[model samples]
Target: MEGHKLGRAPNFTGACIVMFGVNLGWILLLLFAVYGLVAAIFLGLVVNHWVSWLEHRKQLADQRYGDVSGDT
Candidate 1:
């Protein structure tokens, strides 16, 4: 009976390792997805800010020099 139980140890260890690996993979994938979404949102905000600043600068220029296109 002792020998039979010892023989099963390796199989149990292998199953445990496989389960751990699968769980780790899912956890890592979830973290990466969340981080990527946050990054995308941050990038969008930065772009919006730059666009707003540029528009403000254009307005200032137009005010100082008048419309160069003479469109009125």
Candidate 2:
């Protein structure tokens, strides 16, 4: 009955080194919060496939320059 007596200030080997440093800092902050949520869902699917490839290259340059209506 002599396990470094536990009756005063946290003494069972300092409460097992503060419960193994708080369970290794909560398992390294839960693996860096699941790698920052899988890098924010692959950076929002690469910025929504680069804004849908720049709106399909501005509708193929307004069908090769013929749209702003000045009667072609």
Estimated TM-score per prediction?
A: 0.48, 0.26
RMSD of 2: 25.8
Q: Extract clashing residue pairs from model 1.
A: none
* Per-residue lDDT of model 2, residues 1-72, tens digit only: 767777766448778869976975675567557777566566556766987999798778889985775444
lDDT of 1 by residue, 1-72 (tens): 656544333347678869976975675567568787666566556766987999899889999998896646
TM-score of 1: 0.48
Using lDDT as the measure, the top candidate is 1
For candidate 2, the per-residue lDDT at 47 reads 60
lDDT of each: 0.72, 0.71
**Model 2 lDDT, full chain set:** 0.71
Name the 10 consecutive residues with the lowest summed lDDT in model 2.
23-32
